[model samples]
Target: MHYLDNLLLNTDSYKASHWLQYPPRTDATFFYVESRGGVYDRTLFFGLQTILKEYLGRPVTHAHVDEARDLFAAHGEPFNEAGWRRVVDRHEGRLPLRIRAVAEGSVVPTHQALVTIESTDPDAFWVPSYIETLLLRLWYPVTVATVSWHARQTLRQFLERTSDDVEAQLPFKLHDFGARGVSSAESAAIGGLSHLVNFLGTDTVAGLLAARAYYHEPMAGFSIPAAEHSTITAWGRDREVDAYRNMLRQFARPGSIVAVVSDSYDIFKAVSEHWGQTLRDEVIESGATVVIRPDSGDPADVVHQCLQRLDEAFGHVVNGKGFKVLNHVRVIQGDGIDPTSLRAILERITSAGYATDNLAFGMGGALLQRLDRDTQKFALKCSAARVDGCWIDVYKEPVTDKGKTSKRGRMTLARNAATGHYRTVPLADEAVSLDVADAPAGYEDAMVTVWENGTLLRDWTLAQVRERAAAERL
Candidate 1:
């Protein structure tokens, strides 16, 4: 590692000795994560393997401690011993947190154990005990996946009603444009790949790299060659047609697709006059799909207009389902698209006598940055603590806010056989079986031991996650 890399490792100055008062009992503290499920009924499990492999797997080296132990000791003041010992007892300097949870890609119902964390060695309880931040980090990708999963569900509903081949078109319907809109490159990677769990289209380069690095998938998402307004407008309005022609020449090949920003000047004229009439023959003969993107305007209104105009210019063909599709042309509404607007756009296009296949939606800021821990009401709390060989149920029932009331005791998530809904059960449940399929009549454990100590017990690739995420029972 470079000197700078080592320097960066000891950067968690705030978390150093911050656990001095946590757990209260120095021997052991048990904690588990759950989503209280305010806005979402369930959360799609994702990114745990990524978090473990990327963050906790890379432990703080002794060298990192040697360089910055003094500052941490000073920051801790009277608790300097806490800081010093963490470095002195470093075992490959990695965090000594052991985690157990449902398998990654499992669609866990609300108020269930996402993961439970405790110190591996009793003496090192403090090492993993101060975990508000560490445990909370899982919130991002989980929330992203949940939101994207619901979006996929919504699109699937529309596709089922509107498209003949719902399965074929669902993946490409929602594309990730969230790379530049997120807080960092890492966020782009995690959040982008989370969206890819449900759908395959993405423009976030870091997301693809993240999938390759963390999920061991060489290619996690796919995108078409596309142009932005800067490239289109740079050609000037007078040469707009030339720019469109050049994009087609450079990117459009047989059985290929490319997107071009058509709203640089008048989106209507560009769609109707240029792409519709003037370049109609080229578009028809090019044997490639030219996707027109409207970068600005109300998505519902603008995309509805684009679909009708494009159908007029390029002509329309009815699929088996009787939905009109423009020949060699499509519309991608990227501006102001959220779940609400996405559904609205689909509704408008279908109501305008076109199929949901007539358009795709691209989401940027709303897809990644517009969420928080409260988006799904995520919380990690001590539900059980082991003291002197006895297990005690632990929880907080904050009267000030009933919504903040947390679950108590050592809990295991299990699928209730009668309703097929997952429910959190006390660990002592007589019928609890870890394997859902093998479990007897009443209950099956939904939670699986995914991580133990520093070893990742179960690993999942992007394809595996996509498959598991698609599986209804997982």
Candidate 2:
């Protein structure tokens, strides 16, 4: 019996996320053997599940097939299940010795292999190295978790300026709309899960599936004919109303989220003018509001202008006449968004007399890629070094501090009590002073464990990473 238990589900133990789902779906099982370039991404399920199961000390239930021998099912059709079983029988008990990473979800800078493995038993390890492509497939989640904190900050800044009414009437929404923005399926799924911890919408159904499977959280989904993409893009901007209304009616989804791209023509006019007021009314009257999307121009200016028009046209939604706003329609800023641009837009929108809560951010390119052209939010690197063998890490040196070498051996990582600064102590020789109650706020240690034993230790939900980032004030 493979009954799953949530024993290690506590905040510090397993990865805790906001859009947390109860159970992770095991749609499929894969074995990613380790190699020189990278370690096995899926090699430690046996260890992890075993450890977790033992901790629970009960009947364990989970979805997975033991593939220590041959993998007839995983190879799919044409491999012949019989042949696969034979192959598995021939290779049973053959595996290399690999060390798991120190901690999961810890930031590892560029150049240092996130997860590394070397076989104590080379013969066993040799067989697994043949599967690099498979292992990389699972790297997306780590990659997404890699940058989850930054995305959270962008949302936090926007949420800070929200007003009581706007927040009361409209909701603050963040979405995992990064499928098209990512390079591969694994990346999309993992990144999607990482973000789902805090955001509200995901355009990719696959992302939702992965979230349900891994995090077990139900996330928001996006529907097509969204503001009737075909209609709006097909016809002239002026025809947006008729097209939008027709599409909204034809594909009327109860409590549907209909986002109208306002920049099709004149952005200002699009918001101010009552285009297919009936459709807007439909959304509002139906208790759902139309979501306005601005895919062009300055998001700040557009949002400010849009809010003013909504207020003028509807007349203080709190009143009977103007108050007819249920889902009167909120603004969602798309187009180009980076951390800086996001910060700028949020600040500008707030200063322009609109509550940040009234709008949503649909961050696409910026959230997915780390590009030089766009703003650089943070740098992940192997900043210091721990000496070879029986290594001890030293951030400070008694001699030439200029060398700035890292003390390495095994390490003990802890938050400085008084100062709240992050520091690392060498594993073997424990002889330095690391405690400080007044470590000064704002300074925190950065080396985080990204991978170990070809497995991922930390599976941070979007919210946890985000909260850490917020408190760190990055």
TM-score of each: 0.91, 0.57
Could you give candidate 1's per-residue lDDT for residues 287-373 as a string of tens digits? 999999998887888888888888778888887877887889998888998989998888877877788877788998889999998
TM-score for predicted model 1 compared with the true structure: 0.91
Count of backbone clashes for each model?
2, 43
Name the candidate that leads on TM-score. Answer: 1
lDDT of 2 by residue, 163-187 (tens): 4443332223555556787777755
Q: lDDT of all the models against the reference?
A: 0.78, 0.43
Model 2 bad stretches (over 4 Å): 1-148, 165-172, 216-225, 235-238, 250-256, 276-284, 317-327, 372-407, 416-421, 429-474
Best of the candidates, lDDT: 1
Query: What is the Cα-based lDDT of residue 118 in candidate 1?
Result: 64
RMSD for all candidates, in order, please. Answer: 3.2, 12.8
Q: In angstroms, how far off is 154's CA in candidate 2?
A: 4.1
